[model samples]
Target: MITEPLEGFLPLFRSWFDTAAMAEKVGVSGSPENLLVELDLGPMVEAELRLLNHTPANAAEAACMLEVVRQNMGDAGRSDGLDLRAVAAVQRWLADQSTNEAEGQPVERLLRRARV
Candidate 1:
C-alpha cells in the first residue's frame, strides 16, 4: 500500500511522460528522430501509458508501474537513449516514498548505484 504522499505524486509523474515538446520541460533536450523515438523509449512506453491513463487499481499496482518506469528509464539512460534527469527525478520520488528506513534502503541503494 502507498501513503498519501505517494498517491499524490502519481499525477505529477504522469505529466512528465510526454514525448513531444514536453520532454524539454523534463530536461531532455533535442528532439528525437521520428523513426527512432519509438525504439528509443522501447519498453517504457507501455508502463508510461498505464500511468498516463491512471489504470493502476491500487497503491501496490501504482508502485509496480513506477518500478517498470524506473527500470526501463534506467536502461534507456545507459546508452543516452533517455534523459538522466528524468530518471533521477523518478528515483528521487521513489526514494522519498519510503515510509521507514528499511523500506528506503533498496531505493537508496539503487539511487547510489545509478549515480556511480
Candidate 2:
C-alpha cells in the first residue's frame, strides 16, 4: 500500500496454523471451518500487539515504532541520522491511524498472516 518514498519492513508472519485449534472463525475469507492459512503481520507490529494483548496502539506518538526506526538507523550521524525524523514520521502515522477519529479513519490494524 506504500507508494511515495517507500520503506521496507521485515516480514514475520505466523509460522503454522494447525498448531492451534481455534474455536471462533477468525478467517476473513475462504472456508471458515477449515483454515487455509495463518495470519501474516509485520514483525514489529506483532511484538507490540502481543504485549498489549491485542490492544490497538494508542497515542499519536508511538514509542515502539520510533525505537524500531532508531535501532534500524543506528550509528548514522546527523547528516545521515534519522532519529528525529523517524519519531515524527511515526507520530504522523499514528495520528492518521487513530481509532478515536470521527468515522472512516485508518486505524491501526492487527493483522497477522497465518498459514494452514
Candidate 3:
C-alpha cells in the first residue's frame, strides 16, 4: 500500500490557519510543535508540517504553514530535528503576518529569509 504524502496536507492546514486566524484569533502561542499538539495533529503530521513549512522558499507560505503547525502543537516542547534557527525564523514571520494583515507589507519580505 502506498503511504500518503504528508506534504499533501499542507494546503488543507494552510486553509484552516487562514480561515481560523489560528495564531491571533485562537490565542495560540509558542513554537510550531506546541501548536501541533494542541490541534491534535499527532507527531507525524506535525513533523511533516514543520519540514514543509520551514523548507518553503516564500516567507508567507512558510508563515502560513507555521501557523497551522503552531495551532496543532500548542504550548508543548518540540520533537528532535523539528527545532532549528531557520525553523524559528519562519515561525516568527508567520506570527508577524498573522498580527499584521495589511497589504503594505511586501510579500518579498517572506522570500528574503528563505534558505534557498
Task: Please write out the lDDT profile of model 1 over residues 1-116, one tens digit for every residue.
Answer: 22233354455454434443244345443456544334365434543543433434455545645554565565563353333333344444455454333344546666665676
Per residue, candidate 2 scores C-alpha lDDT tens digits across 10-57 of 121121112111312353355655453455534433443332221113
Reference-based lDDT, each prediction: 0.46, 0.35, 0.48
| Each candidate's clash count | 0, 13, 13
Scanning candidate 3 in windows of ten residues, the lowest lDDT window is 1-10
Model 1's TM-score against the true structure: 0.24
**Candidate 3: what lDDT?**
0.48
lDDT score, candidate 3, position 34: 51
Name the runs in model 2 displaced over 4 angstroms. Answer: 1-8, 11-65, 72-78, 99-116
Ranking, lDDT, top scorer first: 3, 1, 2
Displacement of the residue 76 alpha carbon in candidate 3, Å: 1.7
Candidate 3 Cα errors over 4 Å, as ranges: 1-12, 15-54, 83-116
Candidate 1 CA-lDDT value = 0.46
Worst 10-residue lDDT window, candidate 2: 12-21
lDDT of 3 by residue, 3-116 (tens): 223354556655554545544555545666555336653544544444544544456556655654564456472464353433554545554554443233334444543433
